[model samples]
Target: MSDLPLDQVRTLLAVVDEQSFDRAAAVLHVTPSAVSQRVKALEQRLGRVLILRTKPVRLTGSGQVVVRFARQLTRLEEDTRAELGLVGAAEPVTLPIAVNADSLATWFLPALAAVPAVGSAPAVAFDLHSEDQDHTATLLREGLVMAAVTSAPNPVQGCTSARLGRMRYRAVASPAFVARWLTDRPLPEALPAAPAVLFGRKDELQDRFLRGLTRRGATGVRHFVPSSESFVDAVAAGLGWGMVPELQHRADELVDLAPDHPADVPLYWQQWKLDSPALATVAAAVVAAAATALRQ
Candidate 1:
């Protein structure tokens, strides 16, 4: 394939970020017509529609690919400049990463803090996007993040994956909740109708546990607590039972409903395949932290 024009690709990314050709032009110090022309020329060259010019512009599938290429190009450019001492020493490189809420609440930030600057490498800043581990890879696939902590072992396209470890979760409820709801019958019979706390609409751990036990899903009122800390607080305050991660579990406030069974979610680190030192340093720190924080 022929080479992609750097100016055109960068212009497409600018429009996507700014959401309007006029806004992009303002940022690029060019006319709106020039921005529009660049994007049109890119589309014509690729023989595909790159964008949908909506109120807020939207990227087509091909547009997403080009934007990803543009970001990677930018990353490489910054790395090269930093290595060559062309970038200002005071400026730190910012890496956008996607991580699940649980890991962020527990061990993720510490890992970032522990990352040591490689010889003469620029300092780094993190722009973290918190999502469910099951869905974090979507950010990587959409080019929203350079790296992600995900549950999927398979890598996203243009990325490489490594096994991080397992996050162990136990079915837990407050003693008050158990006395009020679980005393009626065997767990299998009582749990189906009992109130339960969910992390979010995307969370399936509680349902998965229920299905494994009773061959059915929870039928009672579902309480949605989206934040990791609040999810534990909700469960502890007798709002509902939930699958609580081992690191976040409190023996004083929460009781293990199923002491014998636990849900172990396998976590993976996924990042772009580029040989970037900043990315490598962060990835290594994360892997080291997970080694101690998660189940082997």
Candidate 2:
């Protein structure tokens, strides 16, 4: 442990986050060999392998622990500088947060913009990790972000959570597509027959909504568009029908398949329990914006 150097620990974290020794080296302005050597030395000292050398490399269980410590160390250093006024011209606090694509397209940006700029405190720059609401909390657990808007009510370790609001989604299609494919048949029967657009394989929201409405699951044919904006556009372009976030749907003239049965996914903001002024300000702004934009 005494033999382990902080530089080596930080280098390991950089590689894990950047997912490439070459990229980490570039960030550190060092040769890739240097980065590799540092990591290797750290592994030898710790007597535990830190990372899996794979594409978009993954951290080992022990690696996650070290990554968490590295993040904490970085935070502490920043806080100390701020307290000591060592950092000239209060630097903008960069808040890294995990959020779902639906929220990102809808209310999240406006909420971030609403955070008041403090004296010399740089404007908040958000580092957003876009993923499904149900899975956003996993980023927090891995110490990938300082905050998250997730579907999970239970907070991650060392984090606090508060309900943001619920995002309502409706199964929708273009008028032409509905007329051609649905033709007044019961949705469950017609949905399986019509082409559909899914956010991704993990997206069960549309399928779950269909099951509740028609007592059956989604169809086999689905065009995977991973992005929230593109998924809506795919439906609009008559490529396939999908569940569109109500917030995004408000401006569009898309035909709602089942007006009475919209899916409501509750969202929550979870952040580290640290009392950093920057984190607090951002949280307040996000909560305030969510209250107005999302359905309670």
Candidate 3:
């Protein structure tokens, strides 16, 4: 296909972001029919059905590609404007990134704060979306974020991937929990029946640990605490045994259930291979901080 028209591509992005044609029109200060027409023209040019027209407007594979291109074009335009002194003094660049909850709770924010300013504005304003390390790349793939702290080492299409080291997790439980559920029984026998704390339904750390010892999944009551800090708090409050990040694990309150079976989830930094100064600065800060905060 010929070069995608910037106006139509941007209009499609607006619809994706707003989740509706009417909202996109309001944002772009155009009629809803105009928005629809632009999107339709773009789709016709590409010979692809870009949108599913669902309630929230789901994008097709072709749509995702176009949206990613639109976002990159916007990023490049902003960078060019900033370099040429065309940008307003009050507007700082906003960089959107995907990060896992554990890293966000521990080392991620500090890294962002340490990023040096491109000029007068404080580094760049941040828009963070936190998800599991295993799933953060999904946001990157969907054109939702520019960079991600993900478990996958493979690059996503136009992105570069760099190793950021591992976040080690140790199986741990409160003294009371151990006393009540695991005092006399063998760990293999008691653990399968004992209550357990999990970060989310997708969390497999605790279950993975159990599988190593018992050759089965945890069959007991499961408590889901999604936040990293709160997951640790839930375990400390005797909610159940869980896998706590080594950085967040407290020696006094929680005892390691198995020192030999630590779950080491290696994290990687993934970002679009862009030449923008703001993105490069943030990437440097994140890599440097990860070197100190994460296990090498």
Candidate 4:
């Protein structure tokens, strides 16, 4: 077993976080040479190069492992300090989490809000990475975030996965839009010719829904609205029909294109397998909120 020193591990994370040895040195209050030496020594001990000597230092495959370890170590240490009442000089705990845009625009905020404020503990702040649920697991795998709301059921390496629940999407359009394009036509035929709003190119919910019904892709007047909150607004404004998350679907203004064909995307919460109290608290709160917001 490589008995890597804690200081060396911490230095590697600092360099990666700051994105350069010079900036890492500034953060660590050490000379640049010292920061480089520590990272180099850690690489040597681990028998692999941890960083790429780029303008802004990039983490190598090996470096991601070290950085993830360092962050988890830091998290546990801070949690320990708070538990032992020795957190007089500790910084606030900043959790970098990955979540899909739909959840971010909906129930996920409430999940964060449900986390009870821990008095005398380190103040918690969230660095949320808004990504698609289908690809959010990559952020966790790359060590970019500690946890994620991902579509994958399998946990990332060194992480734990819990089924959050299913986010149901309703195919909706404005009443005017439906009357113009969908009222007299078959859904499969009308949907392909009608305008559609998509979150992004990777957003396949609409395409999948169309293909499943018609074996054809969505190729109509498409508007790419990237923001989740604005995506529903676009659909509501009669710009296009879209698969709106049940949480964001404005029922009174919007009419369902196909109420029987709602898409239920099963979301999972993946987090690093750590014993940090704050992470546990956040995970529990997220699960609880998801249970209420999503279909069981």
Best prediction by lDDT: 1
Model 4 residue 174 lDDT score:
98
Residue 278 error for model 4, in Å?
A: 1.1
Write candidate 3's Cα lDDT for 108-222 as tens digits. Answer: 9999888863334333778899898999999899887899999999999999999999999998999999999988888888888999999898887787788887898888999
The 0-to-1 C-alpha lDDT of every candidate, in the order given, reads: 0.90, 0.84, 0.90, 0.88
Off by over 4 Å in 1: 17-37, 54-57, 117-120
Q: After superposition, how far is residue 90 of candidate 2 from its true place, in Å?
A: 9.1
> By lDDT, is 1 or 3 better?
1
Comparing 1 and 4 by lDDT, which wins? Answer: 1
Model 4, residue pairs in steric clash: none
- Candidate 1, RMSD to the unseen true structure: 2.1
- Judged by TM-score, which candidate is best? 3
User: How many pairs of residues collide in each model?
Assistant: 0, 1, 0, 0
For model 4, the run of ten residues with the poorest summed lDDT: 114-123
The residue-by-residue lDDT of candidate 2 on 53-157, one tens digit each, is 999988887887788778777666776676777655547556789999999988998888777653334355678899999999998888788899999999998
lDDT of 3: 0.90
- Candidate 2's displacement at residue 219, Å, is 2.2
Cα lDDT for residue 153, candidate 1 = 95
